[model samples]
Target chain A: GAGVSQTPSNKVTEKGKYVELRCDPISGHTALYWYRQSLGQGPEFLIYFQGTGAADDSGLPNDRFFAVRPEGSVSTLKIQRTERGDSAVYLCASSLGGGRRPYEQYFGPGTRLTVT
Target chain B: GQQVMQIPQYQHVQEGEDFTTYCNSSTTLSNIQWYKQRPGGHPVFLIQLVKSGEVKKQKRLTFQFGEAKKNSSLHITATQTTDVGTYFCAGEGGGTSYGKLTFGQGTILTVHP
Candidate 1:
C-alpha cells in the first residue's frame, strides 16, 4: 500500500508569489489534513477535509491560505501573496474513516516551501 | 483554542540512558497520538491512546494517558542512537471540533553512542 505522497519536495519562490502544494493520500483514506511546521517548532494544523468538503479550516492562518480536496483522494494547498513567514514544511496526512477518532495518521515527506 | 505543551524541549542522553517527554493539553482530549520524526524526515505515527489512565507499550517505548485525559507521556528505555529525533504528542479535538489535532511543541531528543 502506498503511503501519502507530496509533490515538489522543495520549492523556493519570491515573496508575494503564488504557490500550490499537492498531496496524494493513501488509498481508501477519507480524512485528509494539511499542516505547517516551522523550524524548531511542532506542526500547526492548517486545514482538514472529509471527502470532498473541508470540515475544519479554522487552523488556516488567514484568507490567503486555502486548500481543497476535489475528489476526496487528492488535495492542494494554495497560498496567495506568500510571505516570508510562510516558509516552512507543508505536511499532509490521511487516516482511515472520518477524523472522529484519533487514528494513526500517515504523513507524507512534505513540501518545504521557502518564500524568499 | 486548544494548546498542547511538551516539556524538556531538548534533551541529550547516552546510548543506554532513558528518556521521557511529557505532553499536557489545555482541554480534555478524546484521544492522544504520539509521533516520531527523524531529522530531515517527516513524522511517523507511533501509537494512539484513547482510554483514560491507559498504558501501552511497544518494545522499549511506553506510552501513558493521564486519568484526566488531558495529559500523556512517552518513555523510552535504554535508548539507542537511532532514537535521536523529535517526539510529538497530538490531542484529538472533542465535541464539534473534530478532524483537527492540536500538536505539542515537541521534544527533541539526541542520543550519543
Candidate 2:
C-alpha cells in the first residue's frame, strides 16, 4: 500500500500457544525488516529480507521465533510456545533494496504482543 | 557486540525550552540516522548523517555527526509540546554489514505545557 502496514495491532496469547503477526510493506520496496521492542528499550533487529529471501537472521533471539516473506511483499512473524518474556511490540519496516543510499526506512504501526 | 548507548534516558522540558540527546557507538559508524517515536506510536525517520563532522537542521531540530564517527547528537532548538517523544540514534557500522542499523537506547522527552 502507501506505507508499511501491520495487522491485528495487538495480540494476547497464553503460554505454549502459537501466534502470528503480519506486515504488508510498501509497494515496490524490496528490502524489509522486522524488529522487537521491549518496555523502555529501543527496537531491536530481528531479521532482514531482500526480496523473498532472508539475507540476515542473526538477530532472531531463538528458534522459537521465525519470520518469512515468501512473496517479498507481505511477511509474517511466528512465535511458538509464546512466553511472557516474549511480550513486546513487533515492528516492520521497508526500504528500497541495496543501493548507495540505504538511508531511510518506512515503518509500520507495530503489533503489541502480550503473552500471558 | 557493536552496540549504541544513549545518555539521559529521560528528560522533561517545558514548552519552548531546548532539549538535546547524545549517542555513542562502540565502533566507528559509517552513517547515523535519527528517529522519533511518540508515545504509543511507531518510530518516524528524522535525518541521516554520512559525512564526518556534518551538521543538518530541520526547523528547530539540529543534528550533528562527530568527527570520530563514533558519536552523534540531536538538539531541538525550541521544543514544543508536539516534540514530546523518544529520540533514537541508530548507527551503521563501517562495512558491508553496515546496511542494517543498530539503534541506541532512546531518550524519552516529555514537554510540559
Candidate 3:
C-alpha cells in the first residue's frame, strides 16, 4: 500500500506571498495531521483532521496558517503572507483510526518550504 | 498547553554500545509514541505506549512508560550504525484531545563504527 505522500518536495517563495502545500493520506486513514519542523528541532503540531472537519487546530501558530481536508483523504495547508519564520519542513501524517489513543501514525516525505 | 521535554539532545556512541533518551511531560499523557527520523527523511513510527508502567521491546530496542504517565524512555542495547538518527517522543493529552500530539525536542544519536 502506498504510504502518505506530499506534493512539491521543495518550495521557495518570496516573503509575503501565499503558498499552499498538499498532502495525500494513506488509504482508509481517517486521521490526518500537519506539523512543522525547524532545523535542529522536533516536529511542531499544526493541525489535525478527523474526517472532513478539523478535530484540533490549536497548534496553528496564527490565522495566517490554515488547513483544510475537504474529502477526508487529502489535505492542504495554506499560508497567507508567508514569513521567513515559516520556513521549515511541513510534514503530513495519517493513522488508521480517527486518532484513537496509542495509534501509530504514518508520515509523508514532507514539503520543505523556504520563504526568501 | 502541554509540553514534552527530552534530555541529551545528542548522543554519540560506538557500535555495540548502548544509547538511551528520556522524555518528560508537564501534564499527564493519555498515550505516548516514539518515532525515528533518518537524516533528510521523514519520521517513522517505532512504537506507542498507553499503559502505565508499561514496557515493550523490539529486538534490541526497549521502550518504557513511567507509572506516572508523565515520562518515558527509549533504550537501545548494543547500538548499531543503522540506529543512528533522531528519536522523538510525542504525547497526546488526556481527554478529547486525541489528534493533537505534543512532541519533544528529540535526541540525535550517532553511532560510529
Candidate 4:
C-alpha cells in the first residue's frame, strides 16, 4: 500500500508570500498530523486532524499558520506571510485512529520550504 | 505544554560498538514511539512502547520504557553503518489529544565502518 505522500518536494519562495503544502494520507487513515523540522532540531508539531476536523491545533506557532483536512483524507497547510523562520521540512504523518492504544505514524517524504 | 527531551544531541560510534539514546518527557506519556530517519530522508517508525517498565527488542535494537512512563531509551548493539541516522522519540499524551505526538529533539548517530 502507498504510504503518506506530500506534494512539491521542495519549494522556494520570497518572504511575506503565502504558500500552501499538501499531504495525502494513507488509505483509510483517519488521523493526520503536520510537523515542521528545522535543521539540527526535532520535529515540531503543527496540527492534527481526526476525520475532517482538526483535533489539535495548539502546536501551530501563530495565526499565520493554518491547516485544513477536508473530506478527512487530504490536508493542506497554509502559511500566510511566510518568514525566514518558517523555512523547514514540512512533514505529514498518518495513522489508524479511534483506538485506546496509540497507533504508530507513517511519515511522508516531506516538503522542504525555503523562504528566501 | 508537553515537551520530550533527548540526550546527547549527537553521537559517534564504531561499527561494532554499542549506542544508546535517552528520552525524557515533562509530562507522563501514555505511549512512546521511536523513529529512524536517514540523512536526506523522512522519518520511519521503529517501535512503540505502551506499558510502564516494558522492554521490546527488534534484532539489534532494544527499546525500554521507564517505570514512571516519563522516560525511555533505545539501545543498538553491535552498531553497523546502516545505523547512521537520527533517532526520535515521540510521546503521546493519551487523553483527548491522543493522536498528537510531542517529539523529542532527536539524537543523530554516526557510525564509522
Candidate 5:
C-alpha cells in the first residue's frame, strides 16, 4: 500500500455494543501505533507495537480497550462495551523500527467511531 | 501523560497577512515535529526539529525550536487561502515509548482571500 490504511472509515454503534477497528501498516514498516482524537483535540497515543509484541500499551485508558497485531503486520483494536465517550477519530501510524533508530511516522486516514 | 499546550487556539487572517502559532511542552523533548491538517483531511508531516534553537524553513513556512527544548513555533509568511489548516505540534521525549508522540491541541488557521 502507498500508505497506512484503516478499515471502516466511519462506524456508528450503540452504547454497550462491541466494535472493532483495523489497521494495515505500510508493507515493510516494523513499528505500528494507535491513537485516539476527540473533537477539537490532537491525537492521543493509545498503544504501539514492535513486530508481534506490544512495546508500550501504557497509554490505553482501560482494559476495555485492547489492540492486537498478531502477525506483526495488520493490527486490530477491539473495544468492549463501547461508551459515548469513545466517540472519536482512531488514527493509525507506522514507523520503521522501535529502538535506537529515529523514524518518521506515516499516518492513516483514521477511523471515526461514534457511540450513541 | 505528557501534555503540549498551544496558544491562540484560533487565528483568522486576511489574505497576504502573516500568522504564527506557539507550542509549549511540560517536559523537555528529544525531538519535536509539526503537522498540518486541512479541514476534513488527515494530518501531514511538515517538518521535525531536533537540536536546541533549531530553525527550518519550508517555502513560506518557518519553524523554530526553543533552546530549552520545551517550546516550538511555526510561522507562515504572507498567508494564503491555501495555508488554511490546523497546525499541530507533537513532542517525542527521551525515555518515553520509542514511537509515541504527545500532541498539542492544534491551532486552527483561517485565511480569507
Candidate 6:
C-alpha cells in the first residue's frame, strides 16, 4: 500500500502571495494532520482532521492560515499573504483514529515552502 | 497548551558510542511517540509508549516512558552512522485532542565513523 504523499516538493513565492499545499493521506486513514517545521526545530502542530471535519485547529498561527479536507481523504493547506516567517517545511501525517489512545502517525515527504 | 521539550539540541558521537535524548512535556501525556528523520527526509515513526513507566526496545534502541507520564527518553546503543538524524518526541494529550500531537524541538545526532 502507498504511504502518505504531498505535492509540490518545493515552492518559492513572494512574501505577500497566496499558496496552497496539498496532501494525500494513506488509504483508510481516518485521521489527517498538518504541521510546520522550522530549521533546527521540531514540527509544530497546525491542524488535524477526522473525516471531513477539523478536530483541532488551535495550532493555526492566524486567520491567514486555513486547511480543509473536503473529501476526508485529501487535504489542502492555504496560506494568505504569506510572510517570510512562514517559510518552512509543511508536513502531513495520517493515522487510524477514533481509538481510546492515539495511534502512530505515518508522515509524508513534506512540501518545503520558501517565502522570498 | 501543551509543550514538549527535548534536551541536548545537538549531539555528536563516535560510531561505537552511546546516545540518548530526553523529552519532557508541560502536561501529562496519554502517550509518547518517537520518530526519526534523515537529513533530507521526513519523519518516520520509531516507537510509541503508552503506559506510565513503560520500556520498549527495538534492536539497539530503547524507549522509556516516565513514571509520571510527562517525560520520556530514547537511547541508542553502539551508535552507527546510519543513526545520524534528528529524533523527535511527540506527546498526545489523549482527551479531545487525541489525534493532535505536540512535538518537541528534536535532537540532532551526528555520528562520526
Query: Across all candidates, what is each one's fraction of true contacts kept?
Result: 0.84, 0.55, 0.84, 0.77, 0.68, 0.82
- Any runs in candidate 6 off by more than 4 Å, and if so which? none
Candidate 2 Cα outliers beyond 4 Å, as residue runs? none
lDDT of 4 by residue, A33-94 (tens): 99999998888889989899998898999999999988999999999999999999999999
Instruction: Please report, as a value between 0 and 1, the fraction of native contacts recovered by candidate 5.
Output: 0.68
TM-score of 6: 0.98
The Cα error of candidate 6 at residue B58, in Å, is 0.2
> What tens digits encode model 2's per-residue C-alpha lDDT throughout A22-70?
9999999999999999989988988888899987787899999999999
Ten-residue stretch with the least lDDT total in model 6 chain A: A95-104
Name the 10 consecutive residues with the lowest summed lDDT in model 5 chain B.
Answer: B92-101
Interface RMSD of 3: 1.3
lDDT of 4 by residue, B26-72 (tens): 99999999999999999999999999999999999999999999999
Give TM-scores of chain A for all candidates: 0.97, 0.95, 0.97, 0.97, 0.97, 0.97
In candidate 1 the C-alpha lDDT for residue A84 amounts to 98
**What digit string (tens of lDDT, one per residue) describes model 6 on residues B16-102?**
999999999999999999999999999999999999999999999999999999999999999999999999999998877788888
lDDT of 5 by residue, A1-116 (tens): 48999999999999999999999999999999999989899989999999999988988999999999999999999999999999999999998886555577888999999999
Worst-scoring 10-residue span by lDDT in model 4 chain A:
A96-105
Which sections of candidate 4 miss by over 4 Å?
none
How accurate locally, in lDDT, is each candidate? 0.93, 0.91, 0.94, 0.94, 0.92, 0.95
Q: Candidate 6 at residue B15, lDDT?
A: 95
Q: Name the docking class for model 1.
A: high
- TM-score winner between 5 and 6, please give it: 6
lDDT of 5 at B69: 97
Best by lDDT: 6
Instruction: Please report the TM-score between candidate 5 and the true structure.
Output: 0.97
* Candidate 3 docking quality: incorrect, acceptable, medium or high: high
**Per-residue CA lDDT of candidate 5, range B1-113, in tens?**
57899988999999999999999999888889998989888888889898999999999999999999999999999999999999999988778545778899999999998
At residue A42, candidate 2 shows an lDDT of: 89
Q: What ranking emerges by lDDT with the best candidate at the front?
A: 6, 3, 4, 1, 5, 2
Candidate 6 clashes between residue pairs 3 or more apart in a chain or in different chains:
none
Q: Can you give the TM-score per candidate against the true fold?
A: 0.98, 0.96, 0.98, 0.97, 0.97, 0.98
